[model samples]
Target: MKITVTEDQAPLDYDQDQVAQQYQEAKQQLWRSRIEEPSLMRLIGDLRGKRVIDAACGEGYFTRRLRQAGAAEVVGFDISERMIELARSQEAHDPLGIAYRVEDARTVVPQQSFDLVVSAWLLVHAQTREELQEFCDGIASRLRPGGRFVTLTTNPDVYFFRPRPDYRKYGFEMTLAEHVKGGAPIRFTMHLEKADLEIVNYYLPLTEYQEAFRRAGFRDFQLHPLHLAPDPAGRDDRADWEDFLKNPIMILFDCVKAE
Candidate 1:
């Protein structure tokens, strides 16, 4: 069955300066620092001399990391101009030779192919399978033959199969409609220290994600589980992370463009 997106299900905008700043702060949350970032960087191993694109690179967080990882060239793109402004400001303050641009991931026109393309929390915004396909296709277009695409996105299973408030302990909660299905809106509320941040993401079934990657000339599409980074303090916290580990809210998607 085809799922139709209503106006209320539209993707949230991060164009406002306040929204962009809040989002940047949200990225520093514990779960991201320990799980999401390490997991993604592990998947994108050895960036030395590689040309990379950080698609939907809000505030150039990962973009700067990519350059620091020794990527020969790195370009970051985000749909929000304010986000780009923040990224550019950082670039000015600390020159990493990274380029920032404002572009929608789904319709990005690739000027040149890259060795790798990484995006975090980008695909979940697709309101429909068609838009998801477009986003996949655009990512594929930006990669050279045999280049990889890695993204961190909402775990469909966590939303459709196990919607719960347990994640609130980890500083976020997902509110879902009683009748969940493809394209259903997912209200994600992040409990920050100062304020709560809410964003909308659409649920696309695993099969739909497979189809989108297959149709976009990608092969060996894989879903990778999150991994927690070692504690900097060397203190054991497995007990505290058990709930989150059992039901991870975000996961990594990895694939390679056909050579």
Candidate 2:
């Protein structure tokens, strides 16, 4: 007997459950490490008691952190329902009152503005600069006058220069150049582990990011360098650590609305 395969099958869209699981595993591997916690905690220290909007609060990793930092109110938004479900589950046990919702960061209109709006690695998955700009504008709109907005993104310099073996000889349908240049409006692809193997990430040009903040009404902006260690262990080699420190890896933009 011969079996026939159906042609009506459809490809699955983005799976929130799978994405949540990926985030859970990824955060455990990345954020749970001690090497990066100090920098993250130090950043959160200044946000204490502020009403915060966590624009892309995946799995509530940083949302819980914000609560621990004493944020008066923390509202989290994400496009993934499963992630939001997990976040909500996490919030139920917290002494701090944190709220998590499934919503698109691209179309954010908060009922009330916040004192600080913070997002981590949001633009990594976005397909266009326009999406990035819109995300920034959404954050700006959700902030009170003189409110602060911050984001952490991979540095483009590290990305565009890195070579991808998968694309080179594997016969991947699209080349890096085509992925970046062929898409309408010009887009970039995340090389993921191939580029920054340890972490799944994407990059945006430093200059373009600076200008994006300016366009979004952030009067002052700054990009701080983030250096990563190889073994997830504290750097013992001062020179290697120093070299990574000197090299641009990721950018953390801290800004405040001008108007």
Each model's total of backbone clashes? 0, 1
Runs in model 1 deviating more than 4 A are: 1-9, 108-111, 160-165
User: Of the candidates shown, which would achieve the greatest lDDT relative to the real structure?
Assistant: 1
In Å, residue 12's CA in model 2 sits off its true spot by: 10
The C-alpha stretches of model 2 lying farther than 4 A from their native spots are 1-14, 30-32, 108-111, 160-203, 227-248
By summed lDDT, the worst window of 10 consecutive residues in model 1 runs over 1-10
lDDT of 2 by residue, 26-93 (tens): 46533234324445555545765689988888778888888777888899988877888888887776
TM-score of 1: 0.93
What lDDT does model 2 reach?
Answer: 0.60
Q: What does each candidate score in C-alpha RMSD? A: 4.1, 7.3
- Taking all chains together, each candidate's TM-score versus the true structure is 0.93, 0.72
TM-score of 2: 0.72
CA shift of 85, model 2, Å: 0.5
